[model samples]
Target chain A: MELVKRLLSGDMRAAARLITHIENELPDAREAIRLIYPHTGKAHVIGVTGSPGSGKSTLVDSMITEFRKKDKTVGVICVDPSSPFTGGAILGDRIRMGNHFTDKDVFIRSLATRGALGGLSKATKDAIRILDALGKDVIIVETVGTGQDEVDIVKAAHTVLVLSVPGFGDEIQIMKAGILEIADILVVNKADRDGADKLALELTLMVDLGHEEKADQKWKPLVLKTVATKNIGTPELIETIERHLQYLKSSNLLEINHKKNIEREIIELVNEHLINHLLGIMKEGDFEKLIEKIVEREIDPYSATDEILKKLYSN
Target chain B: MSYERKIRILVAKPGLDGHDRGALVLCHAFRDAGMEVIYTGILQTPEQIVETALQEDVDVVALSLLNGAHMTLFPRVRQLLIERNAEDTIVCGGGIIPEHHKPELIRQGITGLYGPGTLLDVIINHVVERVKKERWKIA
Candidate 1:
């Protein structure tokens, strides 16, 4: 609780230490998070995601600059993938955001996906909460390089920016519907390339096609082009991000989003506690034996679940 | 409580060093070794590197430079770490240093000094051993 107080007082090291504790999932992290709960939901959380080599980090770097120029304090969580073999990671997104290293107001932390099939680390949501409590005006969560299906960011972010670049593949790859469906904005970064216009145009048509069916949808996703390295079009991109946030505010969507985020966190916490408690009572390898029994056809999977649930509820 | 912790390292190049092959190579080696490496690309100032080490809460700061400014840059990074209350963060260097500078560099509280052709595994082992020995942070 003392650490949580320090975190609320904007102690950077306290925030960092709490994040690591959450990342490692220490028992105390839960308690500390409870203390942090009342202070949550202040900052605007933006999620930036894209495939590898699509300039996600570079674009984030530019956005940080734009946000800083507005005198808004920013916190960045950059998630990179951990090796499945070694469980090690090179959180190299900091390399692009290096210019902000000495800026006191901008706190950038890198996270490893740690084998979480989604683009974000398990720690990301809590980390965002900590920064939001730390009084950051804008908090950015940059996902690990994602494929088309990594849309979990939609749950964690108020606005999601899905980036694309040319040379990734053909037009069909661009027209595909998974991540594109979740985008509040589609950014074609590295837009100086040969096929930049084609990519943006294709994405625009794809976005427009999706809009035709849901004409009542409040916010039409914008298609923006940016050369992040050269700082071209970044100002407009960030303005669009802010615009989306304002739209969320003026409409009732911000309240709706806050309600959804609250519901998601509670459900996730309940599920985590249920598993931890159930596993705590079971003998080691007991679950494996149950699996073996199912595989051997001695018991059905539903019965195994019922048995576990009985144990969970009997006490 | 027994989760395997990831050792975070910041591989940085400071003082106008354009040649970053050594730093980049070490990033891959560190990643493969299961450490979380934050590579701050070339031309980083000591202040920037130290700031990163503090923010990322990295266990090690690995500096690789080819600009013949190691003596100034390495000592300065160490000093900045001390100034920032991060004396526990290890400082390591790999560049074009000569034998005569080794003692002075060590005296300045820099460790794990290496030059070209030194096996990355040796550095890896050094990091693993050192980090493991002091691994009670936030436990």
Candidate 2:
């Protein structure tokens, strides 16, 4: 509770320590977050995701600086994958964003995927809330160079910027329904590359096509080009992001979207808590026996699952 | 929802060291050992490194400097850690450090002075032990 009070008072040390607690799921962390929950939903949550090597981190670094120029405090959560075998990870995104290391207004934290397949840490949304409660005007969630199925960010962010680079792939890459479709803004970063113009053109066409399909859609997603490393077009990109935030505000979809996101989070938490509780009650030795039986075809997985659920829920 | 603690470590290179082969190799080594390692790349100042350590809340700050500023930069990072009230965040350094330099660095509360040809297992084991000890203090 003291940490929550300190965090609300904008103590960065308390903020950082609470994030570690959230990531590790310490006991007092739940209480701290519960106390901090009422003051959330102010900061604009932006999720930046794209394929690996599409300059996501570089773009985020530039975005942080741009937001600072506009006098906005920023919080960045950069996720890298954990090793499947060792459960450890090399979170090196700070390598590119080192410029803001000494900036007190900028808070950066790196998280390992921690076996989460969604290109994000399980604790991301909660950590975003902490930053929001700390009074950061902008919170950016940069996913581990994501693929098609890593669309979980759509539920966590108010605006999502999906970056694509030249030479990444053909039209099929963008045409996919998962990552690209979730974009509130599409950025052709590394636009100084050879195929930059063509990629931007294709994306523009795709945006137009989507608008034609949905005539009642008020906000049309924009396709912008930026060479994030050199900072070219970065200001325009930030302007677009700010414009999107304004749209969310004027339309009053910001709170509406926040509620929807929290609704989904509650469901996910229930499912996770139920499974964890079930795992706690189920004897591991018997669970291994069930697994052995299923692998040997002595019992089907569905039946085993049903039997376990039936046995546990009978109470 | 994990009860087991994960070791969060920062592998930073301070001063003008463009070469990061050793730092990166240790990154992979730590990953293999199941620790979360934050690498800020090369040319980082002691202040930047300390800020990173503070924000990331890392259990350890492992400095990898091949630019021969370890004597200055390493101790500088240590002092900043103390100044920032992060003395609980242990400090360690490795890279072309002279054998005679070990005691001075240790006296500054910077340990794990591993030089070249030191086995990866030894370094990993040292960090794991140190972090466990640090956690015991907290718990």
Winning model by DockQ: 2
Candidate 1 DockQ category?
A: medium
Local error of candidate 1 at residue A54 (angstroms): 1.0
Best by TM-score: 2
List residue ranges in candidate 1 displaced over 4 A. Answer: A294-300, B135-139
Residue-level lDDT tens digits of model 2 in A12-98:
989999999988888998999889989997888999999999999999999998999999999999999988899998888888898
Q: List the residue pairs that clash in candidate 2.
A: none
Worst 10 residues of 2 chain B by lDDT: B130-139
Cα lDDT, all candidates = 0.89, 0.90
| CAPRI grade of model 2 | high
| Tens-digit lDDT string for candidate 2 (B1-139) | 4565789999998999888988899999998988899998888899999999999999999998876788999999999999988898989889898889889999998999898888999999888887777755642
- DockQ of the candidate models in sequence: 0.77, 0.90
